[model samples]
Target: MDNEILLRLYSIYQKELYLYLYSLCGERQQAEDLLHETFLKALLALPGGHTNMRAWLYMVARNLFYNQRKKKSREILMGEQEYLSEKQTDKDLLEKILEEEKRRELYRAIRKLEQKKQEIILMQYFSGMSQKEIAAVLHITPENVRVLAYRAKKELKKNMEEFQKKSAGREDTK
Candidate 1:
């Protein structure tokens, strides 16, 4: 495979691959390593050609992440509970804290989802992959992707509602 062609492929898919891996692994360094490793593997394998290069790349990356997880035997998502207590203006600090809290809550809810549903949601929303692209990667019909997405969204909504109720009850107790 020509280096030029490999570079072109990298430029096209690098950002998406990195974001997708990060969403799956939830670690920036691991995601970067996986992105590089995925492209290296692609470079070696691209001579075979592919009917759907983007989907192929996504599958390769996903497989690599899963393999790494299996080898590690245990993977723990890094938590964001250690934000520095820096001095800042009251309003700015308050707003930042609120935003981070909301993001944390959403991530917690996502983590509660089944693995496949989480993959669909992260691929579609976090990595900006189209449903058709996801269908290709997952080897499923586009209609199936839509159906899964609908069900996943419903479940996520229910989980978030439960979280809110629990939070409200906690506040009442306090």
Candidate 2:
């Protein structure tokens, strides 16, 4: 890829790729670092010509994240203390706390799913990847992606319902 086309691709996909990485790791700094590394590797590994650049970038980014994850599995952990140390007004802190709580609930629901379903839900919903794009990245058929997404949605709904019921029961006892 020429520098011009590569620049264009970077501009087009940077935000989405960064957001996807952030969703995966829930850390902005690590996501930014991975985004830069992803583009650098893409620049070096670009073929003579290619199709589905978005899927290709996502695949590369995903691999980079996982590779780094395995390498520093114990060293790298996102701690809540970091957030606590940040300076923030009471209103902003409250909003952040509420948002974090909601995110935790959603993540809990997703984690209750099977591994494949968790992946499908994260890629399709959190990363905003299309079924076709997910299929290309996952090396599965689009139909399979659709099926998995459907099943994942059902499973997430059931998990959320159960959680709500349990929460309600606790509230009643209280």
- CA lDDT, every prediction? 0.86, 0.82
TM-score, cand. 1 vs. native: 0.90
Best by the TM-score measure: 1
- The top-ranked prediction according to lDDT is 1
Candidate 2 TM-score, C-alpha based: 0.81
Model 1 deviation from native, Cα RMSD in Å: 1.9
TM-score of every prediction relative to native = 0.90, 0.81
lDDT of 1 by residue, 1-174 (tens): 788878999999999899889888878899999999999998887646577788889999999999999999886484446465667788978898877877888888888888888889989998888899899888899999999999999988998899889989999999
The C-alpha stretches of model 2 lying farther than 4 A from their native spots are 74-100
Q: What are the runs in model 1 whose C-alpha is more than 4 Å off?
A: 76-87
lDDT per residue as tens, model 2, 61-115: 9899889888988533332422553678888888888677666777788777776
Local distance difference test, candidate 2: 0.82
Candidate 1, backbone clash total = 0
